[model samples]
Target: MTVTELAFFVGASGPVTAEGTEVINQAIEVQTEWSTRNAPSMPQGRENRGVSFLQQIEDPSVYLLTAHWASVEEHNLCIAAPENRETLSKIPPYFQVDKIVYFHLKDVAINSTSGKNGEISILQSPIISVGRLTIAAEKRQAFEQAWNEVKGILEEFVKPNVVKNGWRLEKENETTEEFVLVAGWPNLEKYRDFAQAKDFERYQSVLASFAQTRDLKCYRRIL
Candidate 1:
């Protein structure tokens, strides 16, 4: 199972200053080394598919770290290992550890169109949206069923703006009923114009029918 770790962080003192971001980057450097290293720590080591740093489009101060892993069990094992503890301990000075919240979602392939120089198309895309969709408690199965009804229709409705789109399942233990939806787009204008378009009316209604609340924001990858 492919799992993607999403950690939301803010600066300890206030909005992260330029210098604070630099300090955090330095710490990330250490974590990067530990993540990429070939070591004999665990029986079957964790897989670090790729690491990304994202900044909120509306507010640059809010930071997010996205990491891909093999499974949640493997992720827990790697993070708890003594080899990685030192790096974790250093994060508090630059970020508010108490306020940090995370969710590890089951990720689908976020790859690109094949080419001579292929890459993760999502990262290269101008902006991506990470949507936090909350449904009624214990309504995971119901929500998926509802979405399946409109998935194909809405996919076509959104058109080329939604270059790639999929919902990442939030584990049962993480939250009562939440799905992390990731959408790749070339620009924000095209994405925002969805509401004004007459075609989106019915689909939006279908979407709102199942979703209790949605907190979605555009983000650009900085690292």
Candidate 2:
């Protein structure tokens, strides 16, 4: 799957306000509505599998749109259409254009999907934890090795939930530092508790140390 991630951060000059956020929500809803339509401009045999709008838990002003496509070519064709391009352009006012991280990810490897309880699977998990680690280009191999080795260590923290956590590389980007990490959990409280624990830092230290910048945020699926 070609997963396209678009993180929209709050505009620098504009103050975060309820009215402005409502406008932003309405603008994004337009894109969501368009993706669900069966329009001729859409590729013949390909269609979007899912399009979700996620609100950042720590910062309500930030939002993420995760869209799943069959391939990069299909994704390119869809957005190049005039109408779809215009639909996407409606969202820029709500975000800092330069800060937005728009990229594609491939070769995703996530953990088991069985729920923490019984029925609530990873997809059904209330929070999706996304961590973007910007590694120094030279440290890529060491970073990947360190992260891969700690998967078992991470699993130890999964007391109840499915250990649906793994990493993926960017499918298309000029820079090589885009390593996207994802995990699933029931709520913010559970994640925060574990994040503060020494075990998490034990596994996370090397990964963070290798990266020039690390951004970690938990998001609630709103789509």
For candidate 1, give the lDDT: 0.64
lDDT of 2 by residue, 90-179 (tens): 546656767766566663423224434453434456887888777766777887788778766655564445444333444344455667
State in Å the error of residue 198, model 2: 6.6
Q: Tens digits of per-residue lDDT for model 1 on 115-152?
A: 43433355556777777777766777877777666665
Candidate 2 accuracy as lDDT? 0.59
- Against the true structure, candidate 1 reaches a TM-score of 0.77
**TM-score of each model, paired residue for residue:** 0.77, 0.70
What are the lDDT figures for the candidates, one per model?
0.64, 0.59
Q: Could you report the Cα RMSD, in angstroms, for every candidate shown?
A: 4.4, 4.9
Q: Point out the worst 10-residue segment of candidate 1 by lDDT.
A: 39-48
